[model samples]
Target: MNHEDAEMELTADSIITQRVIARPRPHRPVQAGGKVGAVPDAPLFLHLDAVTTILDSLAREEPVEAGGLLVGHSCTDSSGPYLLITQAIPATLARGERLCLTFTHEAWNQMLDRKQKEYSEELIVGWYHTHPGLGVFLSGRDLFIHQHFFTDAMQVALVIDPADFTWGLFYWQNDELVAANGYYIYGRSDQTYQALAELLTEYGVSWGIQTEEVDYNA
Candidate 1:
């Protein structure tokens, strides 16, 4: 599978674009429950180390925002869930300058040209951006742009709020807009790890019950 180089309808000049490679859609809905563990098998576990690495790269450049492509493996086992196996942080662009989100057209054409040459086939799966003074949630303009251009539900959208150190995930389901159910992950702190783990555990219990969990991890 390959994508062509097309102009991205950026919502802001400071927008940073990232991508992740995903398997073709799963045959099943994965799970029908509403929370993380609700459909435990549907939950994705991102490597804390990998996530940390991406953040560190961004931190190294400070004021300027960074973006890149995410590559990972997927399965449907107990370990069947999606995991952020690895990541590729591209060069950084100035915070207030907008640029079209493209992988050289040549890169996108080959799907995994560069990575494949390195013996990997990870493709574009999602995007992430920093919200400096802006909040962590997706703005109206952000939603509109994402939906209009990238309509894939498996496509992940992340917003990082540097000021408050908060982060969020978003995914689209047909016409219904939805966000990931989990605690925020950011910076060098592991304070939210325990909460996130507990939340996922409860979500697993709720999954068996065919309902959404009331609790949320911070």
Candidate 2:
């Protein structure tokens, strides 16, 4: 049976589950990068905690592909609109292979349930999957999944290569899905800064944290 037959799921949850319905409501506005005014070219932002969660989930699966959902909100400030991904909830029930991932009905339901219970305040921004050693690019199937399931124009797909520690974001550009230029990982400057430093020590991750450090402050 096709997932199109599934009962109407939660609004935001349905989209991730391939049962598109409605877009998430406007979440509170936030300030990220430092610039002000109409800076329309803002980049995607990933929360420090979210990045670690995704890395841990994908890494634990090793050579096989692993997938999950990203939860966050879309907000616009002095610099136009941007996406902020703050959580990565793994799809433990999904089928994964060396270069493929299938979001089974059970898998989507579990992820949707978890997001409702745990991250009630956030929106389902997109989904993330690993390519193991295949590198960071979406295949035809990947694009199909994003287009048919994640319908909202802003919803994106994140692809990662665990073997190389490389990743990229795939978003809707006009009528096409394209790789984003770059993204930012953010957190509370001091404690978050220190914790991130320790968590990503081997990767040479560093940030100058003073009272607060948002690349574009609004």
* Candidate 2 local lDDT, residue 88: 92
Clashes of each: 11, 7
Task: In candidate 2, list every pair of residues with a backbone clash.
Answer: 33-215, 33-216, 33-217, 34-215, 34-216, 34-217, 35-216
Cα displacement (angstroms), candidate 1, residue 178, comes to 2.0
How far out, in Å, is residue 57 in model 2? 1.1
Residues 1-218 of candidate 1: C-alpha lDDT, one tens digit per residue:
01223233222221232333344322212222234454332244344444554566566544444444454444334323353434544433323223222234443323334445642554344556666656656767566546654454455666655554555656655666566654222112343544443443443312222223223221
**Cα lDDT of all candidates, in order?**
0.43, 0.66
Cα lDDT for residue 10, model 2?
Answer: 34
lDDT score for residue 38 of model 1: 41
Q: Per-candidate TM vs. native? A: 0.52, 0.75
